[model samples]
Target chain A: MVVIARSALGKLRGKYDSLSTTEKRIAQLALNSPSTVSEMTIRELASAAGASTASISRFVKRLGYANYREFTMELAHVVVVDAQEGAKLFKELGEGDSLGVIANKVFHSSMASLEATNDALSENDIARAVLKLINAGTVNFFGLGGSSIAALDGYHKFVRTSLNVAYHPDYDIQLMQAAKLTADDCAVVISHSGKNYETIQIVKELKANHVPIIGITSYSGSPLARAATVTLLSLTDEIKYRSEGMYSLISQIAILDSLFMMTVLRSSSRTQPVLMHVRDVIERTREEP
Target chain B: MVVIARSALGKLRGKYDSLSTTEKRIAQLALNSPSTVSEMTIRELASAAGASTASISRFVKRLGYANYREFTMELAHVVVVDAQEGAKLFKELGEGDSLGVIANKVFHSSMASLEATNDALSENDIARAVLKLINAGTVNFFGLGGSSIAALDGYHKFVRTSLNVAYHPDYDIQLMQAAKLTADDCAVVISHSGKNYETIQIVKELKANHVPIIGITSYSGSPLARAATVTLLSLTDEIKYRSEGMYSLISQIAILDSLFMMTVLRSSSRTQPVLMHVRDVIERTREEP
Candidate 1:
């Protein structure tokens, strides 16, 4: 898992902006005419963008690629993944397409997010957190916005597993609850961006009071991550559709749900029997008058 | 696409309870010797439950099956599709299973929902309502709770086109907004279940005012479906781990989004250029100083 330095991201963003008129023209043309530019050599790119080959070469270096060849490879990667500048805001989703096509696309995107998540998770950190959870007297969860759904889900899955778990959606009460926590208690906090001000304050208060904090955020360099004993990441490809990416948010919640279910079952022997009993009850009860 | 009558489900539940003594015997044997039970025949099932073959036969009928053979066939279906239920929860989720296995299960469930939705949708009703939308001078969307997110998504997509659209998340504001509508306007109401009182009230008020109504709900026979000029069924599977089945909900929203987008694009030729220009401006601004 390559930990992309914040500085490197900043450098790329900056250099991407600072391309002069000729270089900017070439870059824009590459972004706009991806198929044509992807097939172009340096001279062709210069001709297409109405720029000099030397300027295109300089633009390649500015993006931190070794040479035009590496730069073109990166361009191809971005083009394949994210470069849809002129695609209509929405298209009539085909009724003609088979269910399998729709499902394949949906699951492909979900698996991509899951892969990014695995890349971001640290085994050592997760092990340490699991050890703490195993030793803790109780686990308290805090979340807000769409994230509160994940917290509620965690609470639901963990409650039946013989774990002393507590969660509520109200933010003020959550903060008050966190304030009452002792060192023996564990707090799991989930926020997508990790920069929501109220969430940060609650986390800060927890840190001041010395509670074990488990953070889950997509961005590893977030303040929430710095305050945590362990963290998990939920990744999303930039969702192209509308107001906010509500679809991707749920997938993130599913990941958290998966974690809670896994941890609860692993730490206790009670869940298995309970589940077996439920299944048997459901199955057996299906045979009556 | 078949509507399972509520009374039918209730009767099924009653019949399930009648199998109590036999279920207990069967559960006991199955728990004690799962492999033996798995290998059992009709004679074995009858004996294991400590009931006669006729009783086992009646039991299958009670559980909504035609016969014991059909019951076993359904059980086999559950085994293949839901093998995870046999082994505790998280252990199945975290196992070294192929992606194809997961994809097959998830896709099969989603397809079932899609088919149900299509079956419940009335083509004649939808055509009349779509014609209203195409011809309307104004369209106001009123929804609250989870429905508000979908409502807002519709509004966002439609506003970019030539149509006059309005949506409010607050309940009082939605009522007020509904009050402001006239006979020329159309209202789209959405709910997963048709039972939400607030939505029903707003729909009734809109009715009194003679505003055309377009409804989307899962239950085709419910009040919302009956009240609307058109209803599009949004189907979902019943799964233990899924509370709202948020991923499935996204499919419903995407359907609405596709409709809204297509409507906008259909109206004025200006929309495509506007969308394309918006993307270009966003890119150039982000790329520039």
Candidate 2:
């Protein structure tokens, strides 16, 4: 076998460095639009990517494949893999992959996400975030899509303490709620893209209103994080493995979980009453139907 | 404050034994479907639930509310709260209560789901499931939606092991693959509800193929688990929370995490190679791009 492929060997990186100039262009174009490669044949791909069929063929051979078919199959594989939060969520719908494989992928990706998040966090940053929640007059959460679910999750865990909390997917009301906040309160915003316009606008409003914000986002430079007083990042390893957005979601939730635990631990004494009261409510709900 | 009524709560053997028959019925219905109460006023609810207005007032009072208006407001509070999981997504995207109130509501609901998952686990059960995985010839993953994400996640972590791994997401294809399996393989079927039709059908195929199945579901008695060789339960607390499905999902993934750790530690030789190989692949890729 030739030695040119990398991602094909599960390396998940460059396979184009050794290519000639024309081959390099094809490789760049293909990497830039891996999705489109799935629809193109060798000849079409070469032409579209500004390379000759000979260069494309030579590139495939260099990648250590027997021929074009094997190469494109791997290309299809990479095209479907989404690495935003590092979750690989495609394959057989039901009679899916081996359980051992499934279990490993899920756990490692989540662990990677957590590690990424932790790496992105500083003790001072966490201390300050903890302080905000502990001292805040109120905490409001805003998220949408799976983020809403994550926000709700964060809310549930945090409310076990004494902090007053709020969250909504509704933009107008979330904005209004943001308006009601002051420097005395802190806002924890959840948005994977950090570019979600409504959430960015809301974060802007929160900042203008003098509310402290803790942001969780995949991208470092997004508006959501920019407006935040403190930011935590969630890392993913399998983001390029699949799509369906589960990878980043788990990462985002993990960060929220961290914030929640920190807040709960910081104020356990005062939060005991609230926690106890909530437990009572839960017990009551469970007793009957 | 007035008591919101529930139908299922009547069957519950909780603290409500002191209530009269009419009150019990109202309470049961309310517990089962609290949002239904939001549509009916105290008088209408009293008649619909087959109780007199006087008893309805008394019933609401018994549940710890001052009057009907208060009861309804709280009912509305529950109704207007955060998003629920499944097909009914974002239909009535409105701001119901204050963002803080909504936030608390969403948080509590998620905690409830996690609590439920915890309740469903047993040390002996988890140990048994882990043992099966550690010793299995191959472990197959099965799921849909968010569950699919969980399955993919499992694959990512385990691929680092020397184990033979495979995962695909198409249900029809999964059925075919299940047919190719032997009893040596273990299929880990994940469903928030054991009730999803595709999940059930896949389980059936695995059954026919004599492949041992490990089920992950919320309810122990659900068909998917009932038919499995091993079953792991992910529970949710009894809150009429939306995004409930996702809670079960988190629970499922958490259990998968436990299983993955167990497998990794148990299979020392296998674990190192998988991780090292994948890491080497990654390193090579890094050098290229």
Candidate 3:
């Protein structure tokens, strides 16, 4: 039997075919009522599933848990993650949604997107991006329309580090900046669709110049994703007929934040003094009033 | 006694002094061990507090609960809210923090800040700001340095709505824009310190022009807080010797998000079509590739 750190429900479904008739009953009950089964003891679960306590004990072990307690704990965690990831229908902005309802929905959606993006991100990509950023002569951020906010944010965060970074609000200026970049420089381009004309233009320019491009976009199959040397994806719920990509901004920001933190930590010896100086500047300005 | 919807722990603390000696002992135990008390049955609590079951029943009623069950449910809610508000020490990035640890800490801190900011927000302020924005001729966002990112974000969000909004990256340009505003316009100013020289200059200009200023700042006692017509506060944990107001950006963005959501919903009649059009544009552009 292969033991793995998997969700209880996942394990139950994965191994359902191989289980005994009595154990299959328990697995069915658990899959059907995860929250209820999570809160149940071994005796309660056994009775509910028409199985015995000994079978319940053996069942949890089969799911890679040492005992029932660990199984329940993992189930509880899955329940929370499921709720955050919109396992239930996420309420969209309706005609008569209250202020409190709107606030809750937006916050929940943002959180869900962050968790999804984090799950999709690979540690290897993050490490590679950090290395490229640390070694780059300059970092340029490219985005247009709605994604410009995220591009500007990336520039803001990276400016705090000991790296030369650039972002421009004007599309033509950004294109010019991209054309001037060399192979020694790096670019972080953001587009939720990853297929914007201007965004692809900048990506082509960077590619022609042989500059390393780290693309942040929602679609893994996007043209920008293909053009970039490395791609980081941001995920949002599949809400049809909604406003423009609002939730993905939070996910994109999270990806940038993680990359920034990694870069700072990886180059702490070089960045510590810079960060301390930034802190001092902030402190002095704040204390002035 | 007057009854109200308050946290169980709040009620216990509020009435602790007036309780009888036996009830005071129960109160102390409940206050000190809210999570434990919430999980305990009436008999369990009585024994734990060295009191009788009758006293526990009476104590809950005094706290405005119909019975012990209601009181325990409210206590459980308090525990969850307390956890969200940073009652437990949030893990900070240490010198030797791993990439996974750094990522988790940043994501958790951002979520915590959003929840805290949401809790601190008053619905009335949101409603009023939305109304002001709807009625205003133009909405100008002002922030310098670290807060410029938030200001830009505010601009990005409001620009999606059916309203006129403006923001500039240069401090002098922002000041000039502020000087040109009138009483019919609105200014949404952001400053983590609420004391930056350029930020205060813009605030003064807005104040002199009698424009309605909506200030978002960390400190409630700063000059910007006092100068603004309405102030919305963003709270973060008190961590000394850190970078320049990084976590507060998440809280500030949350505040802006709430305000934006309310604005869209409150004026859905006018903004709904605009949002749909924006969505169409995004869709059209995304399909170009």
DockQ of each: 0.02, 0.01, 0.23
Per-residue CA lDDT of model 1 for A125-215, tens digit only, reads: 5555666666677888887765665566556555545557899778899999888888888888888666666678779888878899888
Per-residue lDDT, model 2, residue B284, is: 42
Residues B1-289 of candidate 1: C-alpha lDDT, one tens digit per residue? 9966333223334555456787556545544544344346668887867878877677667667675544443343333233334534222233333322332233334434444544444545545665677777798876655465567656655665566789876889899888878779988887766557788888888888888888877778878889887777677655433234333444455446435544543443645566555445433432112
What tens digits encode model 2's per-residue C-alpha lDDT throughout A130-238? 7888889998888754466567657666666688888765679888898889999989898776777667777878888989998877665567766789876554543
Could you tell me how far off, in angstroms, the CA of residue B273 lies in candidate 1 after the best superposition? 15
Give per-residue CA lDDT, model 2, range B1-289, as digits (tens): 8975642233233547887888888877676677677557677888888888898888777776776654654554343332121224222112343222232333344444544555556656666777777777887788765467567656655666666655666777777777887888778888877777777778888889888888988878888879988888877656543234544655666676657655655665667667667656543431113
| Model 2 chain A lDDT-worst window of ten | A9-18
Where's the lowest-lDDT run of ten residues in candidate 3 chain B? B1-10
Candidate 1 lDDT (Cα, 0 to 1): 0.58
Better of 2 and 3 by lDDT: 3
Question: Residue B162: error of model 1 in Å?
Answer: 12
lDDT of 3 at A219: 92
Error of 3 at B174 (Å): 2.2
Order candidates by lDDT, high to low.
3, 2, 1
**Chain A of candidate 2 compared with the true chain A, TM-score:** 0.63
